[model samples]
Target: MSDSNTTHFTNPSTFILLGIPGLETAYAWISIPFCCTYTISVLGNFTILFIVKRETSLHKPMYYFLCMLAITDLVLSTSTLPKTLSIFWFNSREIDFSACLTQMFFIHCFLAIESGIFVAMALDRYVAICHPLRHSTILTNSVVAKIGLAVLLRSGMLTLPFIYIGSRWPYCTTNIIPHTHCEYIAVVRLACGDIRISSYYGLFAVFFVTGLDVFFISVSYTQILRAVFRLPTKDARLKTFGTCGSHLFAILAFYIPALFSFLTQRFGQNVSLHFRILIGNVYLLVPPMLNPIIYGVKTRQIRDRLLQLFSRKWA
Candidate 1:
């Protein structure tokens, strides 16, 4: 298996995904739970997006960004999971190179959008908290729309190179992928041709975007802390921080697993593939599951609204 990767082969055919090994015995039971969770994630995110669009009260910058994030979640979860579950249940794990690259394209695109929207949301909260009087003026609808466009343009452009790079690298005869979806790094690492450019470009892009976003988030929070301390009333400071707490939690939850996965990939080459797959799932799936829950907890108004909706439905 190790030597097979280096030998170039012309017939780059269909690949089999060796989904988390040894779980086949319980595949039936696993499918049921996985399908339920996946459906709920997609449905919940779609519902949030709808509610945000339908409710005029959520037209503010924060909720505008939340709606965008919901859209990202819906697309991201939908793009990767349903097919994966189908493969697990039906044993239809074969995928051609072109299809794999397409999957890789959306994965990175959605990831970039996720990070971009998160940074924008954090900035929105910072402005709202530190400059409450001018919040409406600063976060105008036009401004929010521009931010959304910029994120889409930037993420889409950044991922185009990846598509080009993928096209150039011919696959070897060995046709086994280790995980469910076409992870960018994992896919590129399998190429028989030179991947120095892809590796360099990818690492630099990840560090540049995710790193800069983290830095900006840190700076925003620092300013927020200073502003909070100067508040005359404790209640005022708490309220201000509370506004951003959800965004902060979501950022941490999403970024930490991602950073860890990439770092381990770079340095922990000797680690078992099973562990890597476990962390990969955590990186991909956990964030979407946590984002809405975190926001629901942090924002009392949103929380109350969701609870009221659920109660009315269940009653």
Candidate 2:
């Protein structure tokens, strides 16, 4: 293996996150919407956590997975948005190399964890609908705990290489990352060496995490649909479908933007930089905001409990 440091270039100690390239003049104006989105995401995820904690009826296998998902979303959004907001509002974009790496690690790790949680939730739905009698037995507290730990470990293991490899790469080019945060590919592109290995590893990591989770989620839902359609009565089918509506919407919200951004990053080289950045931000922000709303509206138990909680407060 060649020494990564032998490159004839200077590696800067810090990086400048160029939030939304060419839109520097509109940073203040743009921050308003970004702030609103962040605010909503934080509040929404917190509400979901609070409701899950306070409501006894929601203490089930499915809601436990929802709580995990909410926590992941909260962490993922918070990991980047504060720094991004600081850049937009105060022009504080300079980040230490280690800090950038840390942010990048958490951003990708939480995203992977969230994806894993989505798969778990899909599996929960599958077992509930397809194997109702065994759902509780299969997804006990210990089982869910194990699954969460496994997901965290998996995310850490998969993402550690990206950071480890990146930390070793000679970032001798301009330390200006043309996005809101130090994403894996964005930072990797700054290195002044043959980055094909790191690039392919990053691609492999994204595909391994998102692709496999999506595949499993799809399979779970396919089995679920088959089971749902087999219900003897129309009301049974509708009621079973109602239970899954939130998860389906959550699946769509989480995966669509993620896959879009991932594809754009890979294939859309000619795509507008601004559009790519916007979609990346959308992937970061939208699901966290939409998830709680979807669950609050579509999940009947959550909706009734929320109404009851608010009504009691008003009374």
Candidate 3:
């Protein structure tokens, strides 16, 4: 393990990814699950996009947000999974400095964007359930388009600094990262100089994007619940909450694992390195795989459309 005191380079051309530091013997086995995850995530998200595009009845603000979420998930998983698989299956770990920064940027950027989409979806539900009469008016096509653009711009602008800082920083300590992908913190840890700026900025970005998003989502749901309970009948309450079931499941699916992984990565010093890495991989892979499934199962419209499409092919 090379440290800051080791022979340093002003600018290294490439960095080595170690896949999983303590799990070398199981790389082949690990690749199997990750391959399956990537395949399912791609197929599931694409299916969602296809169904949304082809089904006119489904053209609503909620589905529009779902489409945005699907696209973000596609990019988020793609940015890391291919390279991770290469390292696991073929032992190809060398990544160009520029390429590493690009991967890092996309992974983090799409993550923030995905979080923003969840907040959008939550607000959509809040309006639908809380103010059904004005939901359509409030979340107009133009408004949704502006929200999507804002998400993209916000994530890109915030994440660009990570790339800029990573690129300009002198990597004198080492070029080898112990994880599967080129994470910002992992890369910066190799720098020979003080890394307080990078560390502080990363924490700030996380709180600014994810923390605020989570707060908004929570508030949306709280208002939704208040409105839901005000319904006159038990059946009405159940039916109203049922509409939100899928969104709630999707939120837990994405955030629970993600929060765990982030906490373990930052503070779980006693946790096994491989365990932390695996959790990180799970947060990235599992949500993409589960999002479509949760929506398909809990959403009658999507489920019916899926059945119809499959039936046509079979017939």
Off by over 4 Å in 3: 1-6
Query: 1-315 in candidate 2: lDDT tens per residue?
Result: 345534333446788998999888988888888889889988888887888899987899889988898888888889888999999888899999889889989988998998999899888889988888998899999999999999999999998998898888877636789999887788888888798998788789888988899899999999999999999999999987876776687778888888889788767999999789888888888888888787655677887877888999999
> For each predicted model, how many residue pairs clash, with residues at least 3 apart or on different chains?
0, 0, 0
| Alpha carbon deviation, residue 272, candidate 1 (Å) | 1.0
lDDT of 3 at 256: 85
Give lDDT tens digits, candidate 1, residues 147-231: 9999999899989999888777877756578787777777777778678998899898789879887888889888888888899
lDDT of each: 0.78, 0.85, 0.89
Q: What residue runs in model 2 are displaced by over 4 Å at the alpha carbon?
A: 1-11, 242-246
Assess the local accuracy of residue 134 in candidate 3 as a C-alpha lDDT between 0 and 100. Answer: 99
RMSD of each: 2.8, 3.4, 2.1
Please give the range of 10 consecutive residues that has the lowest summed lDDT in model 1: 4-13
